[model samples]
Target: MATSELIYSVSELNREAKRLLASHFMTVRVEGEVSNFSAPSSGHWYFTLKDAQAQVRCAMFRGQQQRLGFRPGNGDRVIASAQVSLYEPRGDYQLVVEHLEQAGDGALRQAFEKLKTKLLNEGLFDESRKQPIPLIPRKIGVITSPSGAAIHDILTVLKRRFPVVPILIYPVAVQGESAKFEIQAALETANRRKDADVIILARGGGSLEDLWAFNEEIVARAIAGSHIPVISGIGHEVDFTIADFVADLRAPTPSAAAEHAVPNQAEWLGGFRFMENQLIEKLRRQLSQHRQRLNWLEKALQIQHPGERLQRNAQRLDELEQRLNKAMQLTLKQNQHRLTLGSQKLKQFQPIDKIAQHQQQLQYLQQRLQRAMDLKLVTLKRQQAGISQTLQAVSPLSTLERGYAIVQQHDTSKIVKAAADVALDTLIDTRLAKGRIVSQVKEIIRD
Candidate 1:
């Protein structure tokens, strides 16, 4: 191997290849001729699915052969639904067949798709509508053929996972023309009785025709309508059915369905033990804290005596009393000293003497103010005389007195300044300095 390169053992390599192939080609429906077919004592059927150009090994377990219509020999053409896988021991690639059909069974495949589309459009296969499967069911109801390997596998797996839960078998035919009716009735009956918390609808793998009962609308509707959540364990891992879509949960096989229905007992027990130990440890820690507190309280009570506390309180009261008395004496002394200083200062003020001095100053100021007022009055009177003379010089009355007459319209009192101010025969008013006269114009004049 190259340095630092990851390497795998033969078994690991084969397992990894098988997982890759299984995940890559989840379900394949292929047509090929059967060759080298063999059925062993172990109830398993082995064969080679081949075409002219290629071949692949195939296995159909006995559990899947109940409804296989005919045994396919070499040279027989067939169709199968299978998953690609590698057998680790032999390191050989092979196909694990889920269902086998004769050359012309493509019609069933088409019908399944058509029904799937119809239900999907109707919201019957909606994820929101699916009920939650109970992790720990009180009781589980199974709808399948009582004698089939599917029922046995489910019971065995349930015993291994969780055996406390009761299993109620609702015997019904898992194949044939009446299988759909039986399944529908079983589902309705399980719901009506309310005996089981969850329902498991299961059957073994077979030809497409044999498993068609699960693909029927009646069975699908019954599963969808059931009050109890339904878990469909139909055929092999590669098988797809209408019931699978309608059910709350779908498992590849009956054993897997049982595994999904409950949790592992060993794991749960281990978890419970761990939790119990943790709880005990926490309780111990709390008890230790409480014990420490109790011990501290006991020692504190011993160290602190009630009599000692009383003595300390008495001393504090005496100290406070002495301090209060000293504060009162100091306050009184301060007040007395302040009173003496205030009295001496009040005597020094001498309000009467100060008032007399202020009166004298006020009298002198009054005389000065009176003199100033007299001068201001004289100045104002002079100014008034000058303004009167100025007004007389430019006054209209003085101009009129100088022999100039003012003329105006008699009725309107409008002044006439020019010859055009009067119209012919219009009445006029003429005013001298002393009086006014009214006259009429006899002639028209223009200047």
Candidate 2:
């Protein structure tokens, strides 16, 4: 044993000590006042837990911090569930905090839960009781510390989005014993003034104890009773206070509250421009349709005019006259042929009595032919008159005389039978009872 003596470095000694402490006191629960609490960027909480006679260093890793129901601060008495360990690098004994809660705060948590349950049963958190945020507020009232960063953040956001809206500040203490009373007073004052269209109750991020003022029952009741809509922007996004539930609206931050209270000027202007464009397009379409209708009417008037009717009637009358002349000429030719045949027959007989008898017969036949021609001519004249009358009855011009008009395109001279056949601003002709009119289309109505 004397010959086996071994040398050890400082690191090796510390490692052995850490291994022994970790193995023996694997788990523990300690009670003490938290002090020198510090949280670094690595998300580890470093603190000293001290009693009247003894003190120990503690470290709560990020994983353990997540399990804490309430944040622990300096002077806060807490029960820490931890593991006994040693820092191998420093060779110092410590407790590795796995879970932590405020000393005797279990009762407070129970009370909070009970109150939350009671209020929920009473319907205080109903969505129907929540008020709508004004899209564009005339004035925004803020209830917070005058010197705090919450007020500055809110003002900055409002100025950026909508600078025209005025702001009213209701300064109040955001912490400590009198903080809840001060907050309630500010809320009442804002409502009494009735100047602000919307109100923002705001505070910066803080620990659970620091934000306890917002969890007061009086603050919640005051927010619910406010005539003006209240928006709660207390603490960080992860923190929820009683005031948040009773508020008309909830924002994650003070700056976000300002954003919810008013409309952005740029967005509103863009919307107005959009609506104006739509109205202009509608008017243009209406004008085009009206122009089409006017053209159609003008064409109808020109087509139905008395002048057009007269010209068409005259042309038809010429056709009738030509036909009558041809019919009379044919009849005359047939009678002339019959007379020549009879004369030939009488001449071939070569007898004086036959010639005299034939002459008398020819005279009588001539008289009878004359009578037949007169009767036939009368019949043909009557037929022609009747046909002319029928044509007049059915003529478009006649319809125009009876208070109708015909529509046609001036360019194509095509009849317009339906509204779809016409277009806006087209040159159209209309025939009336007396004259024709050429006009551009102004409007058209359809069913």
Steric clash pairs (candidate 1): none
**TM-score of candidate 2 versus the correct structure, residues matched by position:** 0.56
Off by over 4 Å in 2: 1-101, 104-114, 303-308, 322-447
Candidate 2: worst 10 consecutive residues by lDDT? 104-113
Overall local distance difference test of candidate 2: 0.85
Candidate 1 deviation (Cα RMSD): 34.4
- Shift of residue 260 alpha carbon in model 2, Å: 1.4
lDDT per residue, candidate 1, 151-176, as tens digits?
99999988998889999999999898
TM-score of each: 0.47, 0.56
Off by more than 4 A, model 1: 1-103, 307-447
